[model samples]
Every structure is written in C-alpha cells, then in structure tokens.
Target: MNIVIVGAGLAGVSAAEELRNQGCPGQITLIGAEPHAPYERPPLSKGILLGDAEPDSTIVHDAQWYADHEVELITGVPVSEVDIDTGHVLLGDRHLPYDRLLLTTGSVPRRFPLADRSGADVVYLRTLDDALALKSRLTENLLIIGAGWIGLEVAAAARTAGGTVTVVEAADLPLAGVLGPELAPVFVDLHREHGVDLRLGTSVTAIEQRGGRTLVMLADGHQVSPDLILVGIGAEPDDHLAVKAGLDTDGGVLVDAWLRASDPHVYAAGDVANQEHPVLGRIRVEHWDTAIHQGRHAARNMLGQDDPYDRQPYFFTDQYDLGMEYVGHVGPEGYDEVVVRGELDDRVVTALWIRDNRVLAGMHLNDWDAIDPIRSWVGREADEELRNTASRLCPR
Candidate 1:
C-alpha cells in the first residue's frame, strides 16, 4: 500500500512520521515544493529575521532521519494535479498511485494589489527563502502594509534592529478584529512604545517607485518613502489541487470531524483543511500547534481510527520581551464580553472572552503560567464565581 502525502511542511512531515510510527509497512512518499527540508515557520519572522537563529536549524529532520526511516522524500517539486478518479497524483508527466492521500498543503500570503501593479518590490514572508531575503532588507527603513500578527512581529524585529518601520493598517487598531477592542491596544502600545510609526485607520492607495526609492501614498493624503515594503495582511488556503479535483471547499478543503475530505478516500489537515470542529463548528487554523496535532490525528483517521479532531485552536507569538499563548478560537460569530486580568502596562496580562455566559476563548500575554487554568476556564460557564478568576489567575 503506497501512501503519497502532498505538502512537505510541518503537517506533511508529521503525518509521514505518524504513519511510520503507526507501523505502516508499505511505501510512504512525502513531496515538497520547496527545496529545503520541512522546517518550522514560527522562527522565520522572529528568530530568523532577527538573526538570532540559522535557517538550517529550523529543519525538523535531517536527511539521515529520512534515509534511516526509509521514507521517500521528494523536494523542489509540486504535485500539479490530484486525479481523484485514478487515485493518483500527477506531477508533470509522472503519476504516483496512492492507497491513501493526505494534503497538508498549507497557505499562501494574500498578495497586495497595489504593490504588484506599481512595480514596487514588496516582500511577503511565507517560506524559508523569503525570511532570509527579508532579513537582509531589514537593514533599511521598512514600510509594512498590514498590522496583523505577522506584520507586527516583523515590525518589532525591525525596531529592535534599529530600523525605522511605518505600519499602515486599515483597521482602527492592530488586530482589532481578532483580539477585539480590549486586547488589541496591548499590541498597539507595544509597537508605539518601541518607536513603530503606526498609522491605524489608514489604507494605501498606491505604491510608486521614484529615483530608486519606494513611496507609499496613504488614504489620508500622506506619502512616505521607505526603503522596503512588506505585506503581512493575512493568508489564504492553498486549495487549488483539492478544488481542481472537485472537492468541497469553503475557503479551504471542507473536511469532516475526522479530517476526511469530500471523498472519504482523501484526507486533509493543517492549513488546507477546513475541518469540522465538534465544539466550534467548521474552522480552519494556520497555527503551528494545530498543524502538528492535526497531522497526527489525520494519520490515525487514515488508518481507519475514525476519531474526531476536537483539539482547541492554539498559537503563540514572541516579540521583544513579550510572549503570548492564545487558546480557543474566535470566529465570525464573535464574543459578547472580555474579562481582563493583570494590567497591560505591567506586561503581564490575561484575557477571557465570554459569549452567552460561556467562556469561548482565553489568552495569556507575558503570563506564561496562566495557560493551564485559562484552558480549563474556556468552554465552561463564566458564572459569577468564575468572573472573580482575575485574582486567582494573575501572573506570579
């Protein structure tokens, strides 16, 4: 039985490892579009961009590991099509038949429209090579197009490197839509305090290149020339292969609670899978933790375990002296109220989101020890007794 897995990121490598651990004696082929081995992406914008870590250090498994495990590792190639009828993946003229197929094909950054048309050399951080290139360019004054997590992390890194950064965000607050009004200001203040020129409630009308310098024209009639422009707005699921194969996709490949796609024979995990969460309905997470765990779970389901993927969404970020872990997910339905513990000024904060009297999400910013209790509180009642949790869960 040959198992062909498309995508060689964290999820794909994880699924390959799990398949071997599960005692699958047949063939296992892992294909990646990037030439490099599977590596952790979290360090790209943080440690890699900051020049604190080497790119090769991020690799999950060296060549020796793959050879020792007898796993077929294919790099620098992409599977152009998935012939569902034939149960094979097409790579140019080659067709690899698979007893089971898993797609951990992550996501691609959303391209900036103005940057492309204006002939401006804008940077987007997604791959290992991208980070290295952006690292060299960080020596220049940077203009960021978005105030999302990636944008902010890069801004923090740039500021720490003594480079000027101007962030233009359409939203009134950085991450206002995701963190809500209560917690978004924490990031805004963090950047402003570090000398980030944050222009909130602003949008870029055009990007122009003048005399070998890039100028960004804003909605408010302000034009600024910067050495580099980076777009970190967000990403979209890379579901072209799945969609071309005629699978159901809503922003991503639609999968059941078990991570099986429209066709039971095909499975998807990681950023590409719009999985059915038992507790949160349908959701797609692009975080590192989600990708790792979902790969393992999807592998089990591929082995016919038929277990539901019910893990809560989890992600973390590090910038300057700040570190945060966010558990649970806030979808389009939103949350009703937020309870704050500790003060943002002190740099140790915890926040809980409640809706219909039930805690829906929780976060610990620079309060690393609060996650266990925060996890317990989420999906539980936010009654009068729990409302007093601020005192109990305050950072030590």
Candidate 2:
C-alpha cells in the first residue's frame, strides 16, 4: 500500500505520524507547499511577534526526525492536480500513484482589494514568513483592519512592543460575531485598559501611501496615518484540488462522520474539511486542536478503523494578562441565556452559553481552572441552583 498526504500543516503532519504509529506497511509521502518544515501557527501573532519565541522553536518536528522515520518529506513543491481516475497526483512534470490519499490543504488568509497600493506597508499573519516580516516592522505606529482574534492578538503584541496601536472594526463590538454582543464588551474593555484606540462600527474606505506612511481613510470621514497596517479579516478553505477532482464541496471539502469524502479512497481533515460533526451538525472549524484530532481520526478511518470524529470543538488565545480557553459548539443564533460565575471586573470569569437549561458552550477568561468542569458540563442539562453556586461550580 502507498499513502500520499497533500498538505504538511498540523493536520497533515498529524495524520502522517498516526499512520506510522499504527504500523502501516506502506510508503508514505508528505508534500508541503511551504519551504520550511511543519510548524505551529498559534504563536505567530503572540509569542513570535513579541520576541518571546524563536521561529525554530515552533517546528512540529526537526529535520532528523523525518529521516529517522523513513517518511519522505517534500517541501517547496505543490501538487498541481489529483487524478482520481488514474489514482495519481500531478506535481509539475512528475506524478506519483497512491492507493490512499489524504487532503489537509488548510486555509489561506483573506486579503484586501486595495488597487495601486503596494503591500510593502501591509501585512497578513498567516504564514511564518509573514509573521517574521511583521515582527520586523512592529516598532512604529500600527493599524489593524479587523477586530477578530488575529487582529486583537496582534494589537496586544504591538502594544507590548511599544508601538502605537489602533484597531478599526465594522462590527459594533469586538468579537461580536463569534462571542456574541453580550460578551463582546469584555474584550472591548480589555483593549481599552491597555490604551488601544479602538474605532468600532466603522471601516477603512481607502488606503494610500504617503511619504512612507500609510494614510487610512475611514467610513466616518476621518484619516489616520500609520507606519504599518495588518489585515486579519479571516481565512477561506483551500479546496480547489478537491473540487477539480469532482468531489462535493460547500465552504470546504464535505466529509461524512468518519472524515471520508464522497470518494472512499480519498479523505480530508483539518481546516479544509467541512465535516458533519455529531453534536454541531455540519460545521467547519479552523482551530489548532480540531485539526490535530481530526487528522488522527482521518488516519484511523483510512486504516479501516471506522471511528467517527465526535470530539467537541476547542480553541485558546492569549493577550496581555488575559488567557482564554473556549469549548463546546454554538451556532450563529447563539445561546438563549448566558450564565456567569466569578467576577468579571477582577479579570476572572467563566461564562456559559445555555439553551433550555442545557449547557451548549463555555468560555473561561483568566480562569484556567474552569476548563475541566466547563467541558464536563457541555451537552448536559444544568441545574439552576447547582450552576449558580460559585463554590461547587468551579472547584479550585
């Protein structure tokens, strides 16, 4: 048997490692579009940008590990096409046949459509190279175009580096789309306390370079000049290869509960896979933890294990003194009610999203000890009296 993995991100690398660990007697090939080895992306906006971590420290595995395991690791080369009928992947002039294929193509950052504007003063934090370039230019006035997780984290890093920071968001509150409007004020207050000039419910209509500085024209007839601008709107799944091969796709590559695509021989995981989650229905998550577990589950199914990827979604973020870990699943409508424990003013709070007295999701801000209990409460009906008890709810 021969296996070919299309991407070398966290999901692809995890699937490759799982296949080897399961003692698969096959030739495994890991192809990466990036020139460098696999690396973690969570720290790119925080630790890496703030000079707390070196680029080499974020690598998933060293060069010698791949050689020792006898896994063929190909970097800097992209697979142009995948021939489902021929059972081969086209790489420029060469083609490699595979008995089983896994696609963890991941996502690409959304870019702004500013014409005639050079990208020299604009940056996006998706790849390591982008992070390194932004890190070098973090010494002056910095303007961020989005108030999502990436933009907020980058704002925190810029402030920590002594750079004048300003954030512009189209939403009325920061993180309103994700965390909902009720909880968005927490983040708004967090940034304000750190001296970040946040302009909410507005957008940049025009961006122009003037005398080495970037002049940003806002929707409210105001102009501000900043040395650099970071755009972090979000990302879109890279599913072009899967779509060309005649596979079903919506926002991402559609996969069943077992992470198998329409074609049994081919499967997808991570950010590129729009999976039918057991609890959340059909959803696509671009989270680090989701990618790791989904990759391992995909590998098991590829090996004929038939295990469904049923884990709840999870993600974390760090900014200044605030550390947050969110678990569970909630749709765009959000929860019916929000239950709060601990003091929000003290920077220690645990908020739960409830629907019909059932805990749907939970978020812990500056409260690391609530992770276990919060996860345990998900999908379970909560007792109002028990949930209200601060002592029993979160035991230290």
Kindly report which residue pairs in candidate 1 clash with one another.
Answer: none
How close is every model to the real structure, measured as TM-score? Answer: 0.97, 0.96
Q: Which ten residues in a row have the lowest lDDT in candidate 1?
A: 387-396
| Predicted structure with the largest lDDT when compared to the true one | 1
Pairs with steric clashes in candidate 2: none
Encode model 2's per-residue lDDT on 286-348: one tens digit a residue.
999999999988888898898889898999999999999999887865778887777777768
TM-score of 2: 0.96
Candidate 2, which segments miss by more than 4 Å at Cα? Answer: 115-120, 384-391, 394-396
lDDT string, candidate 1, 1-396, tens digits: 688999999999999999889988889999999999999999999999999999889999999999988799999999999988889999878999998999999999999887867877788999999999998888688999999989999998999888999999999998887799888888888899999999999999988788987888999888989888898989999999999999899999999999999887899999999988999999999999999999999888888787899999988899888999998987888988888888778879889898998988999888878888888888999987787765577832
Clashes of 1: 0
Give the Cα lDDT of each candidate. Answer: 0.90, 0.87
